[model samples]
Target chain A: MNTAMLLLTYAVVLGAVAPAMLQRASWVERAPRLAMAAWRSLTVAVPGAALLAGLTMVVPASPLGAPLARALDACVMMMQDSYATPQRVLIIMVALLLSVAIITRVAYGVGVELGRAWWERRRHMAVLRMVARRDVRLDVLVVHHRAAIAYCLPGRGGSIVLSSSALSALGDRRLAAVLAHERAHLRGRHHLLTATARGLRRAFPLITLFATAEREIDRLAELAADDAAVHASDRLTVADALLTLADDHVLPGPALGTTPHDTGQRVRRLLKRTPPLHPVVTLVIALLAWTAMAAPLVAAAMPAVATIGVDCCPTR
Target chain B: MRGFGELEAAIMDVMWAAEAALPVREVLNRLRPDREPAFTTVQTVMDILYRKGWVDRRLEGRGYRYWATAGRDDYVAGLMSSALKSSPDRAAALARFVERMNPAEVEELRAALEAARTGEPPP
Candidate 1:
């Protein structure tokens, strides 16, 4: 396989091992979103950088490209036979790794700085606005505007500010429904997803799929929040609030419910959802994933895998 | 005051109308003479009111003086306005809230919004 494929495989190996080893039970429940995000990252950002680093190493360490190397070596033989030296491969790999590291560090710093600044600006404005405090202290700050929705901002105290517009827009019944939707985001701590998406993007800038996954998971988070709002109040009121908010033109603030895809798409899903995965199905899926993930390790530990495989395959 | 429950709203209405805090006895005296409540009941209600963060009390000699923590109109206005600001789709949510309200309630919301927009008391 090309270096890119190999590196992507390596990354998948690392990524899979981490969650399987360290993931909590709740995290397993959230796997659909995380899995989609991982797949998206793989497609969008991983391949190109891995290819760059892998090619740099593979091209030089092995004598496989003799024709190409010899031709290039001849041109520089008089002055610098050193041009085709195997050390170039090592240098290239190191340089690629260094470049990736520096770029990631810079991008992460900038993204964090920008997110913090944006949230800080919102905090100042939010304090001046008067709103009723909900009973639970979820590190959420709600400011009422015209939209009947909720959203979370990532970083720092990441408050979910609502609008006076949304409050007065929804009747008390619907308003309670909407507030529950926002509260769900705080409870689930979906801001962590934003951070994950941001980290993946920073690390693997080329992955378009990661962005799609991030956006989709963000939308799904909204669906989950809608379900929460439904639980807190009437399903119809929450559904109506979602519909009304979908028609709203207000731009989302730094926190959660402000995006176009999140509002409309989320409401639609909430209205149509069958119950989420049954506990048994979810457990089985979790077990199956972990088992599939561990199969390679099991095979590696047991040299009898060939015989076992042969017996299982049975000449077919 | 117009749409309030008995003792709690009445106390607030008195506090809002008065320029200064009133003693429990004075507040009790001001109520219609035919409908006198037990002084202790008034006092208890006032205490409950204070606990709801609706009123502030200061001890004076053997008794206490009570005043509203927020004006009746201001508290309702604040509640309404704050609700509007807390969601993502505020304007539409608010518009829907307004649209779904009964005529009288819609009128009040409209008046509130207009007053808020113009920075004036509702006429």
Candidate 2:
């Protein structure tokens, strides 16, 4: 129950549980990368928490410091006492749970506001207009000579924009690949996923797990989109389509390419012909992971069974 | 007049139709019988046209009066050249568009261009 004991227990608990949680939440193949990143972020944070716990052992003077210092001392004493009642321990746990809840609520509010701002700033006009021809009725806008540029703006009935220059730069096969890729985005509603992930990240800034999940999921979503493109056309055509656009200057925006996954990843994935998903394997692994997480809490409750039985008799 | 999706055709349409510096509104109205946009929209589109060196705009009244700088044949040729500058596949799109043109359509464009260039017919 002393500060060091409490700190060490917390560190051990967090270090063990965090990795397992990350492993379960992360993409099966990419779990190691997510775990390592999570570890690095946690490593910096855990030491500071341990230091705070260590400092809490020393009582201080001054009216402000007296109350807080005494509270810490009492908490330490309760934790250090081997025979401390389960009810007292439960009280401390409830306080910590409340703190986590408050922090989560604040984070979510921030994320929602930030997400709304991002959605507004990332403007994409659905109507495609060209500066050249007065005729040629078409639904999507096409700039005359500015081919090698294409992007899907997010919204209801969002149109895929392409410049005439882009149309000319890409051969038929490559053009088909580009259309298929953009279509995949439209069909799957990738923009909504990106927006949701961004909002979650803004809200839970401290929890790298949420942000990491969003980033990896975004990349995976793109990969899924690339798969759609491949299905629509040939894999090589999709790869070639990416290569053409890769060299071209990207449209100005934040959500465009901040994430690390790109054309190269898409092409490499296509070349390897990665299995999209194996349903049975995923289900089994998910079940086992959930069981592992639940086991410790169930076992921890066993020691208090006698106390619970005694409480039933009341004052004898 | 109406918003041009392609510059050459737009320029050709303007040149063939207008004898003087017609305002953007006049041009737009001449182009589309179905939907008439505001004067500002037409002017903005015309401004883009002027910037692209597709048409000539002269100061007239409070607004700028516009005229196409290229004749029908010249504009069509420009369109062909611009399409070629696009990807090789665009060359196919252009070729297909061109193949659909009748002899009379080709002759009319040539005649218009010749008339714009020379005041009189060939002797």
> Best TM-score goes to which candidate?
2
Error of 1 at B85 (Å): 14
What is the C-alpha lDDT profile of model 1 across A71-177, one tens digit per residue? 44332242143235678556655646754664666467447634543554354333322233332444334443434444344334444554445556767787677
lDDT at residue A248 of model 2 (Cα atoms): 45
Residue-wise C-alpha lDDT for candidate 2, range A193-302, written one tens digit per residue:
55544554555567664456555555555566566677778665565566565444333222123322344455554544355335675556555544444433333333
Interface RMSD of each: 13.7, 19.7
lDDT of 2: 0.48
lDDT of each: 0.49, 0.48
Cα lDDT of model 2 by residue, B47-100, tens digit: 876887767877877988777776544533344333323332231111111111
lDDT of 1 at A145: 40
Second chain alone, TM-score for each candidate = 0.62, 0.52
Candidate 2 stretches with Cα past 4 Å from truth are A1-122, A126-140, A145-147, A249-261, A285-316, B1-28, B31-123
